[model samples]
Target chain A: MLKGHQTWVFASKPVIRSASAIGGPFEAKGPIAEDFDTLHSDLMIGQDSWEKAERTLLEEACDKAIEKAGLTKETINFFLSGDLMNQIVSSSFGARTLTIPFLGLFGACSTSMEGLALAALMVDSQSAEYVLAATCSHNASAEKQYRYPTEYGSQKPPTAQWTATASGAAVVSANGEGLRVTSATIGRVVDMGLKDPFNMGGAMAPAALNTIEAHFRDRQLPYDYYDLVVTGDLGRVGHSILSELLPKHQIEIPLDRYQDCGIILYGDNPDVWSGASGCGCSAAVTYGHLLRKMKEGTWKKILVVATGALLSPLSYQQGESIPCIAHAVSIETE
Target chain B: MLKGHQTWVFASKPVIRSASAIGGPFEAKGPIAEDFDTLHSDLMIGQDSWEKAERTLLEEACDKAIEKAGLTKETINFFLSGDLMNQIVSSSFGARTLTIPFLGLFGACSTSMEGLALAALMVDSQSAEYVLAATCSHNASAEKQYRYPTEYGSQKPPTAQWTATASGAAVVSANGEGLRVTSATIGRVVDMGLKDPFNMGGAMAPAALNTIEAHFRDRQLPYDYYDLVVTGDLGRVGHSILSELLPKHQIEIPLDRYQDCGIILYGDNPDVWSGASGCGCSAAVTYGHLLRKMKEGTWKKILVVATGALLSPLSYQQGESIPCIAHAVSIETE
Candidate 1:
């Protein structure tokens, strides 16, 4: 049912039966490398192009999730996916291989939660017995499309983030023994008139804050109700901004319990500059690390807010500011 | 409830309370010009860039839809939208202006029905009281990104389809006095190994047929159940191909009631080559022309299948075959 303005409280509480995360060479060396289901030693992952490699990652994640769920692809009623590519080709191509009824989404980095929220809704509403939510991103592919080609070795400001080469998939089922998706808060586009694409985290911080505030307000829950709250890819810059902004809004998320996927993904890897930021950064970290942690009894309930900067290369070139959004999914173990 | 593997039977039957179609100069010259709420004499639509113009069209359509629904933007719970631009900037920017909780989608030309289906589902499931589904495309914007730039004035083959410059928006509500959305069939990606980006219609025809067949089979409805069956933008080439393919699959949509938005939009305009094709073509025609006809008692039931060629310019450049998808929504007047 609708809560407050934008939140949906899933009365049926759809379960996430299983999840998988696939990563490339760089992610294989990350702090949470062990959390991934599959980590390729090569970025290309046997594909001829970066885009193809990204698609492969997504396909593998979906297959692994389904297998772990003890289900076949044919049993899944729908596949909702997206990626950080021109026209979201990775998700489309990945869906082509999965051959499940597909719904293509595009929320930039926030696609993971967007897909998951919709998937849970489908299951909760009895529209589907099983639904797959998946998303992927490739560093090289994103760089080539969004900015300078990697071959150019373009210099970047410290505010710039490294796009994670990873993929994540989760299976939401009407009946399952796993973590339940209890609620979700869909985000409104928020633009603070920041035009620097390199500083995406900074651009998206307000959106993350807006969604988080909306989530708590709509759910009518205390800020501390969840053991932890994670922002998808706010990184250090956006994370800091959000931290400063929260208190001003009279929202008090415990510092110890609040974290960001971008900041934690690489764990102080200097090469990443601001932090990891991409569709896959949040997807891989949440589906793999956070969910695993929850299952391991580290936390009972958590809210993941996946953030996205809604700016295309053309938009930036045309002097348009980055419009950002975030989607928050509340997952709980009972 | 799930009717079949891929079809959703909305027990609540969400109503399309109001819809608006906005078109550019070329569409103003089309047969359905009178159906549109607003038509701009300039392709730019008072914007400096084609992308911005496309965003303006979407915004106008959305505003018109909400106003016609006798509601304000604040009363709408969600806005689901997509466009042909890279990362779907048009929808994102439009969402920024509308400031509604947004869900971004990407189905190439099929985005219209994809958004509508999801919007209906949200309302049918009682997740939202009101949801806006909208999409748009611009001839110049699509051409610059997918094919040659408008300034190039490049020669095109007969199989090439003209991209429509238009936008359409529909407000789906839990309770309204209008056409009801009874069912929706989500589509799987289908590839026939066609790699030519110029011939999107040819590539997408199979997908359109695939979804139409699924919709009928899953709903257990007869071929002639609806008063009309309209494909999004198959153009003449893809339309003919689909007509022949339907018989092969034993799916018989009556020829008298069958139509294509692309073929009918321009009404034998030779400059359009094969016909009009874009995200907006089906959207404008369906929301504006077809719905108006239905309200005028031209028909009681109709099925709209929006077809999309999910191929990026980069994908085609990399020699990847175009993947296509189609979504079918059943609209019935009580």
Candidate 2:
């Protein structure tokens, strides 16, 4: 977001909103009459491999965000970004572009929330006046590196999410005239030892539920305090499980007001089984949908929770199951 | 630099005075330690693949350095680290473990100096009092992902430096009694357009030479002003070229003082021709040799310039020569 093509496309809108929830009907950024339908970064120069492509996306995102925020790169205190790559390449690439000091973060599909949580802490601690928290996912890179390539024609399970071929970034400023990260609860990385990566939604529900449960308990806030509670990349299966498990755990939130990135991607299409979970799913959805809602002011408080699966090929080969972790952040309009 | 088995048979101590030069006649950190050295990380749970093993090494190195610097996971301002992996996984993993918001950096082999430059800028800006600038490299991971794996038995040229099978890390803190990043000049990536991964030393030498020349000219510092100017993993062939090139550029540094990671690997052994220039080459040499000299007080006012060969298999496939970059940092005793 520093000073990149994507941010220019999004921030060109004459009207910007201030809100907490993407509760109002969704609206994309920029003028509808604009001729440009895409915001792309040229990857021809230094990017050749899939890894390089990932780095390009991250660096471009950070550059655009920093530019959009109108702050010197050195003044930005911390970098908080995540991706689906084995070691979070996207964030690392973003960190390299600017001379600003930074940190890399990981939360699997729930990275945006994790980033937001860390950003909120840095702001609250007065450690940094501004922090950049971004997340990205690439379909081509993810396919070749994580799942099967398009040529493999491997069947995806209902719970699996198609990683986005995009990147989203945000600049979290403590005193900015926009929604602020109010509070966050760092979720425990709980491992139920679930073996199926395809059904990660089912495996990650427990961790999300635990964090949400703790968030409300710690703040003594009621479930109704939040207008929407979003879980990242949890397709239909995990959503169903979370809906049932939350109630079983004596915690309840309205199902209609709950959403997942997996559901959003299909748009009522039957092909997507559950949802999508990649580094980009939460990032694009949050920036596009949630930020748009905050502009319309339909709701006051919204919660975004991102989940990640910690598994390496070697671990899977050794018969190890996936261990899931989730991090939650509350965004509200002041 | 961390807890690892099969490493650190010998390690050079970080003496206060003589460790300023990055590639001078300094002792290595763990390569000289006693036999049966062990490296481990507290946060990461698994390490079966070469990638995971490298991740473990980097994570532990940063964790130990940060802990020694008396900063908490949240207190440390930011995490800066990089490597030469396909997607630069080592730095990403380190960020996840430290959980101190971080940025992933990539100056390729120049990552350490680049990281320190950014950390110094952050400190100067008063954005954060403490910034942990660290870099790591691993032989197995870099080879398999960046070049042909050792198992491939690919013939390496005389110009190539053997990738060091190690990871090295350090903490840059404003309040700590360690070497401070006194001055830094970001190197302009110079592409000599040399097309050979095996002979990366040759490709990177021009960039290293460029940065060295630029730094002295920019700071108005003359040759022989300091004890030494150490260039990162320029291997035997690249080091020789650098020694030859500097004189042509009207900047003369002693050839006896000129060294490369590969030259130090076997230490005058003809068998390990050239030297080591993988990501770990610069890292091990810097943390080992430079830090040792600083501790011993044998030298002062050393210029540590780390160089990187920016090449990927995809680029090679495109018939593109590897373009290289270097970053020069001046580290002096507190």
Question: Against the true structure, whose TM-score is highest?
Answer: 1
List model 2 lDDT by residue over A1-334, tens digit each.
1110000011111111111111100112212111111344443224666656666666666666666677666666556666666545455435545534444445566677766665655455444566677777666777777667779799876567666555667777656667666666655546676888678888888877877886677666778788999888777888888989887888778777888766664455555556566766666667666766665897677888777765655446557566666667777766
For candidate 1, the docking band is medium
In candidate 1, the second chain superimposes onto the true chain B with a TM-score of 0.98
Which numbered prediction scores highest in DockQ against the true structure? 1
At residue B96, candidate 1 shows an lDDT of 99
Cα lDDT tens digits, model 1, A227-314, are 9999999899999999999888988988789899998889899999999999999999999999999999999999999999999998
Query: For candidate 2, lDDT tens digit of each residue in B208-301?
Result: 8877776777566668776767878887788888888989988887666666655654466544457766555666567666666666896766
lDDT of 1 by residue, B252-296 (tens): 888789899999899899999999999999999999999999999
Each candidate structure's TM-score, on Cα atoms with residue i matched to residue i, is 0.99, 0.66
Q: What shift in Å separates residue B52 of candidate 2 from its native position after superposition?
A: 5.7
